[model samples]
Target: MTLGMVALVGVGVALSARRSGREASSATRLGLAVVSVLALWLGATALLASTDVLSFRSARPSPWPLLPLSGIAALLLLGRAPLAKTLLANTPRHWPIVAQSFRIGVELIIFAWHQDGRAPNQITFEGRNFDILVGLTAPLVAWLVATNRVTPKPVLLWNVLGLAILANTVATVATSTPGPLHLDWPGAPFTAITTWPVLWLPALLVPLAVFLHVMSLRQTLTVPR
Candidate 1:
């Protein structure tokens, strides 16, 4: 399921780039390079977890390496606005927003994790996290925008809401984890996110989601109605 989501995101980006007149070869190469690097990093993290080297329950609380990496990527994407905007401009304005439908699957996975007691309830829909609403509404909002029923202002508001929801979930998860920033919880800490497959949530999916929101906002704010 994780791989499937990752593949969808990668394909969406590559296809959009190609449609925007980017060289197919260059886009493909770039996509492959990114996938390869992430795959290797995930593999290494999984191996370390299996060896008990990345245990969230440990005394030191194994660091989530991907957090910093994703942060850096976000900074770069935001800092290099001209380059990012140029690439985003070529793609269909609605693709990034529509692609967010993948979050529905992510929410489902979170529910499963909650059922298994791997994740704290605070991060689930039954708790403080309302991210599922964003996932459920993404397609409708995207359609509205594409058909001209909705203006960029509404889309901008939706993106802002989505970002807020994402930020809340991230903060909840971080505080629930067994780390320096961890908050005291009753039953268990968020150990599952430190392991395989789930690790990709913070490592890849979150970063991609954030990028989509940022780019969509940039497009909507800068482009004329």
Candidate 2:
């Protein structure tokens, strides 16, 4: 599922570049390559988790998942540098925002995990996480931007809202997991997220969602008045 979403984003990026009638610049290529590498690394991590090669069920000072999460965060911070800013600015403004639609799938996966008794309800849409709304409305927001029916201000606000939801879920997942900061819950903690496929939730999808929101906000804020 994660790979499919990554491929979709890659296709969107390629199509956007084609529609713009310009070849991808070196920086754009580099950015895409970096994302591709991260996706591959996440896939490998999932495979390892599936085989029981990596486990975070026990309470530890620092879980192995934190490594990838921190790496992704570092990459996002680096993306804010001048070169990455130029590459992202050259990309279609609507692409990143549209990419957020994948959150719907992420939410569905969480729902399934909850149903299977692997995840807690607190992180699912049925619980405190309202991130599904952001995912569901992503297409509409993208359409508004595409058709010029809305100004950058509204999109900027939407991005901020999306970011907040993303952060909320991240925190929920972190605190709910069986880690040093885990909360004492009645049912099973969020151990599934530390396993196969679901691991991509924090390792890859969350970071990508954050990157999209940040890039969208930057573009929206920099739009000419």
lDDT of 1 by residue, 115-167 (tens): 98888899999888888898899899888878878878889999999999999
Taken over the whole model, the C-alpha lDDT of each candidate is 0.76, 0.76
Question: lDDT value for candidate 2?
Answer: 0.76
Candidate 1 lDDT at 216 equals: 80
TM-score of each: 0.85, 0.84
Query: Model 1: residues >4 Å from true position, as ranges?
Result: 23-27, 51-53, 65-84
- Candidate 2, superposed: residue stretches over 4 Å from native: 15-36, 47-54, 57-59, 81-83
